[model samples]
Target: MSDSHVTPPPPSPSAGRRRAGTTAALIRAQDTAIPQADRAGSGEPPTPAQAFDALHAYCAPALIRQAYLLTGRHDRARDAVVRAFRLAWQRWPEVAHDRDPAGWVRAATYDCALSPWHRLRLRDRHPDPPSDPADRALQRALLRLPPSYRRTLVLYDGVGLDLPETAAETEASTPATANRLMHAREAVAACLPELADPAALHRGLLRLGSAERSPAPGSRDIRTAGERSIRAWTRCALALTVTVAGATALTLETAPTHYLAPVSPGHAVQGLPVPGSLGPLSRDALKLSTKLRKEAGGGPERLVPQAR
Candidate 1:
């Protein structure tokens, strides 16, 4: 048998542009689908649900691409984007009210991809080797960089986020963000000499960014996950309420009651004397006893008032 080799076709120049146009169209379509009732009369944004749908349609692909660049795996990237979107849906009101919902989603996606909860699972799945020389080199170089540097590069260059926005997304001070970007560019350029020029690096990243086109998660899956999250949170709240109520009830049941004690020994009058049964002095003593009993819980042994 003779050995044979086949070469893949070159990527279309228009593919990236087409994808961009399609994403915009999807957003427009989602906007058009929103019911008129969902919009406010004062030109405010649509309802959370409508806003979420539109934002998801428009930004999901780009978010997946950004995640893929960060994690270097398509499956992990998709999972991260899905989880992030689910969270966004749950916090739709806040997200809808944000000045930049897409930026919020991007930040959430980044956090999801790097969350410590996935560390063990991520370790179990080995990454596939890149077939392209350029990609292999870039991936290796990226893997060598710390997460902060990698994220800075991916956000600023690959995702086309401006410096301040990139800083906000990464939760870094602006100067720190700039420093990281500078270091990342130098590192990547050293690894891939062709990317030494700033312009070339940006162009290369844009090209690489456009190559990722993982399918957006279905609305059904996102909705289901959002519902599950809501149910879990509600169950936790109910459990807490029950626990607090039980503790309060138990404490109340076991708590002691208090009573006032007698002010003096043998001063509590047992009964009233019969009329004409006592002398004048006895009658005066009885009147004093009644007054003392009214002032204090029990009558004082001495009827004389203390001098001020």
Candidate 2:
């Protein structure tokens, strides 16, 4: 409702380039800080710490901005990124080998930011006063979109991910992602007509980015937070596993047992008789059986039968 924490107007093109350069520099600095063995092209993947640092430096700021756009809260956005990176740290071995580890973190942030758990907390926080009418309008428009469309827009346009990358991050097919992007663009354009132009849309997003340009956490802070999160997550997982296993065992132990005794041959044959060839009986056989039954009854005499 308010832009109290909203980012300022978009920076000039040259200033945007400078900002991009600074981000790249931050990433480079973090990369170089890693142990020699963990450096790129070292024929070995970075250690968890090294990988976490690299990913956080490169992705955290953008992820925070994206999450903020999704949640409309700076604190929630930061928490989402932190939690996402924590998970990435826990599974660093797998993440380190990923072709786009930053994308993985971005996807996780998306999930965290939009989680239903945040809704109750959001209700408790006071809404900021509206700073700019345009910013407020854009925020309302984005929030009005369904989660899927909103996430697609954030990942593709806000996070600067390509269509395929966005689809992969969103776990949707490429064609579906393209359709979603088109729909999302149309929706936003409907609300903010200037976004009808592609360049204007990008510029609008750039302005949003410039408004809330917070720095990422330091490597040590990320490491500490990540380790704590991993430990808590591991404990929960283990407890859940144990609970499920115990429940399963208890159910099996307390279940009723039934053993059927073998049926006698005579009793077994009490139902329909099996056919010799497992096929339909012929008309002749049916007629013969009926005649034999009639003769065996011997109830009535037929004069025609004697002549025959």
Candidate 3:
């Protein structure tokens, strides 16, 4: 992994920090700009990979943020974004032709968020937890919402998807989307009491705006466009490397397709195989074999049942 590719949090004190770092890293890595250059101008639309690169610029952040908000875990959000992309990749031919690909990702992402496994993961991560004032305040604001309203609000208010888009992705009608956005904003407005320093929060949002617009420090010499292209290339290379490694391992472990002439049919029987030849016999089988062997051991001379 690159130095910038933040690791997932261990189940320990630094988890939140790790998650935050990873989220930031992922956002930076994606280069945030979708292009329509690959649109099916001449013939069949571009393949899923082509569409993914085109759409990822516009939708990755929203997908990541929504996943993060829904999951409350950085790694889970990153995973969800990857899953959403995978779905987009699988359905790209149709999706690229659709009026909105962003909607497709959002719908897929929410499904990932609401899954039982994701819920269980959240529980495990936050069990018996004491929260920081900021997190507790955020949670209070979030809990004020019904699940559907909450999801809509997060996608719209938090993740920055507009109402129509949010609606399309969420499979909600326009009126439903508008209604949930209003209620979501209202719920957060009501929870202001728990939130620490309203001005500070506002300032934080401003900083986010500036930071997102500017190239990250220490990486400024490289143009954002160039950097993004490099990152995309890197991602593809890594995926290829992993695929090759896995294939090599599989090839090495598998039996040879062309076997040498059978060494000797008799050699197989001649070898006195050990007692546990069947990849470690189960305890019951071992015990039974031991008992049977003992029964057969009574002196060879012992009166055998001649006529049985």
Evaluate model 1: give its TM-score. 0.66
Cα lDDT tens digits for candidate 1, 1-308: 11122222122232233224544675685767576765647778565566677778788887887777777777888999999999888887798778677778888999988766766885524554356677767777776787899898887666666666677889877777777777787798888989877667667666555556779997667978898989999999999999999999999898877766768656566688766664466788989877877874365646556667
**The candidate that achieves the highest TM-score relative to the unseen native structure:** 1
Candidate 3 clash pair list? 33-57
Better of 1 and 3 by lDDT: 1
Q: lDDT per residue, candidate 2, 158-220, as tens digits? A: 656666666787898777777777777889999999777656776676566555656766766
lDDT of 2: 0.70
Worst 10 residues of 1 by lDDT: 1-10
Error of 1 at 172 (Å): 2.3
**C-alpha lDDT of candidate 3 relative to the true structure:** 0.54
lDDT of 3 by residue, 1-308 (tens): 23233232112111123223443543343333223454337656445444456466556655665565565555665566666666566566776776556667677777876666755554535522114555545655565567687787555545445555567767877776666656565566666643233333333223322222211112122124344656788999999999999999998889597768866545335667678544888899998877766774452436455555
**In model 1, what is the error at residue 298, expressed in angstroms?**
55
Task: Determine which window of 10 residues in candidate 3 has minimal summed lDDT.
Answer: 8-17
lDDT of each: 0.73, 0.70, 0.54
